[model samples]
Target: MSDPTVGQLADVVERTGRLIAGITPEQWSDPTPCSEWDVRALVAHVVGGNALFAAALSGQTVTPGDYADSADRLLAAFRAPGALEKVVTVPFGEVPAPIALHLRLADLMVHGWDLAQATGQRADYPDDVVEQALAFSRSALPLVRKQDGPFAPSEPVDLDASALDRLAAFLGRKVG
Candidate 1:
């Protein structure tokens, strides 16, 4: 357990889950900074992602939003005995399970920010998350080739922008 990815995984998912649990029915229709996805769709994305990664971490096939307690289930799945060390069958290919967990940390935090922006809520993710996500995204950028891929090249940001803002910019998000 030398890597910090395990704990950060729980923190990112739990924080996003708590925020999503608080979303009112009205806010579901609001548009988010993610551009294409509305609040409800964004939530679905988070839940789906949680399910996918959780299933992988637990060495099972889990349909998205299949459980009522998606976030808690996600946390529990990763926390399961030997879950972290299990080999995950990802769509890309087989790799160490921890890499999958590490990838989720960046995805969840970004989507959490998307949810917060959509619903006019504040997420206050720790600075470490920002640091981790930025590093991950930077390293991952070279892997993305398609213009319509999941992420876009880092947009230009002012020097004063916070790390999170820079992350959003770097990930091709239009920061306001």
Candidate 2:
């Protein structure tokens, strides 16, 4: 049986890849909700993350490539036999492969929103994917924040805010 999480990860990668492909030349320098990273840097980070996760799963070093290539490598690695059952050492710490996958999914979800907000594009992420990412973020971010990790403290959002907006706010991005 295939891991359902892998499919979710692929869906996110495809959506984020589309967002990256849609970036206009002028918008490359636009500031993202990530604060320090502009559109170009943010895209680079996501691509690098894909490569990193692929390498972790495959036990082989992978140079950061273009978004589509990196995403392809990531999906291929995760689909490999026993990939999800192995433990991997990511930058933060050693974690189960499934945890790593969820981490990547949540990161891509929020970063995709950041890219969309920065470029004035619509973040048309699937509702189920957004919900899964949101659930993961809610459970994991508290520990990350305690370590003074990349995310800022969670900001307030309206109760009726969209899931994407809520996810962004939970990851410390201000939602209007």
Candidate 3:
């Protein structure tokens, strides 16, 4: 349970990057499951997020960049020895290393699913990763707490739904 976040984050980044890189020029303007954000915008956000997380881990700040560069920076930062356990400053506030990892992991996983669905690709992320992220989301989302916040209430889905679908539903996304 004490494993570093670098490996898992790398997995998410690779999966997400595969989808982002596959997008055709025309597909860039297409609508995503995120509704508000188009393909290019969504890609930008994910990449930008990687940059931010990288900077936070290093106790530094960064200007967001495109997909390739941001991912490069993120991986470089996370690969440093003791990077995951190092305390750093985040935009919202400073947090322990583990907490920061969880926050980014949740975003990356959900956005990975979003990118896959929008681009007509499968979003079967690693089972263990999905399970861990889903478990975190169940408690961390405002839906379960009945609080008003950015997250919408968890929507109903079939009991036999895939874990990805279930997790998306919990985040107010409907998967077909």
TM-score winner: 2
Tens digit per residue, CA lDDT, model 2, 84-144: 9999988778989988998898789889999999998888777777777778778766776
Between candidates 1 and 3, the lDDT winner:
3
Per-residue lDDT for 1-176 in model 3, tens only?
Answer: 33336788888878878888777778888898787899889888888788898888765678687887888788888787787678877654676777677767778778888888888877657877776777877755543344554566678888888877888887888866
Clashing pairs in 2: none
Each candidate's root-mean-square deviation in Å? 2.5, 2.2, 2.5
Residue 81 displacement (Å), model 1: 3.4
Tens digits of per-residue lDDT for model 1, 1-176: 23446678767767877778778999989998887889888888878888877777775677785324667677888788887677787554575777677667767777877877777788767877777778766765567535776776667888788777777787777777
TM-scores for candidates 1 onward, in order = 0.86, 0.94, 0.86
RMSD of 2: 2.2
lDDT of each: 0.74, 0.87, 0.76
Which candidate gets the maximum lDDT versus the true structure?
A: 2
List the candidate 3 regions with Cα displacement exceeding 4 Å. 1-4, 143-148
Candidate 1 clashes between residue pairs 3 or more apart in a chain or in different chains: 154-170
